[model samples]
Target: MSRLRPGLARVEFYAVWNEVSELLNQGHTYRSAYEFLSEKKKITMKYDSFRRHVKAQFAKKKFMEIDSQEKSVIPADNKPKRVVPATATVQAFDSKNAVPLSDLLTEE
Candidate 1:
């Protein structure tokens, strides 16, 4: 039977995880961040797990930031604006005959 704890509480690792994520965003490689956390901070976890957590945290942060920006930029007026179509010629040419080079090049 494996001795590893199946349900490790994330609350215990939150601070260390945030630190690791910040280091990663500052251009630290996973290996470097792992070493720093393991040796200096005395935080221990599987390298793969740490890496995945850091990536997920960063992705979540980025997504939240983007969502906030989108929300702020959107106008308060919720009414839908009417869309006006452009006035353009809709021409249908006979497909049976090969189109002439000059006809094809001219703007309608």
Candidate 2:
């Protein structure tokens, strides 16, 4: 069979792709996702090749999601915007009574 792409031809590439996807779902950036896999010795492709694959996959998935959402029956104006209430507010403390930064650092 003829190869579809230069980098994703190998089965190993799919494994790496899945890992990158999972990492991204967990809030990792593309570079950090690949870096995590590299640190764990789970990826075989070089950084540039791996990065290209990630960007391509991410873009493809994003486009698919947008296409699907656009096809939904619900009108865009009817959709509810998510609103999160603030849980806590910061209170300023007196600098005179606060512990010194150097002391806190040394304690750790």
Tens-digit lDDT string for candidate 1 (1-108): 223365352433576776776787899999898888878845566677677767777799899999999999998996689999898988777768767788878944
Tally clashing residue pairs in candidate 2. 0
lDDT of candidate 1?
0.73
lDDT of 2 at 30: 73
TM-score of 2: 0.49
Using TM-score as the measure, the top candidate is 1
Candidate 2 lDDT by residue in tens digits, 23-105: 88999887897778868977656767777776777788899999998779577679678999988988889898989999999
- TM-score for each predicted model, relative to the true structure: 0.57, 0.49
Clash list (residue pairs), candidate 2? none
Residues forming the 10-long window of minimal summed lDDT in candidate 2? 1-10
Angstrom error of the Cα, residue 96, model 1: value is 79
Residue 46's lDDT within candidate 2 is 71
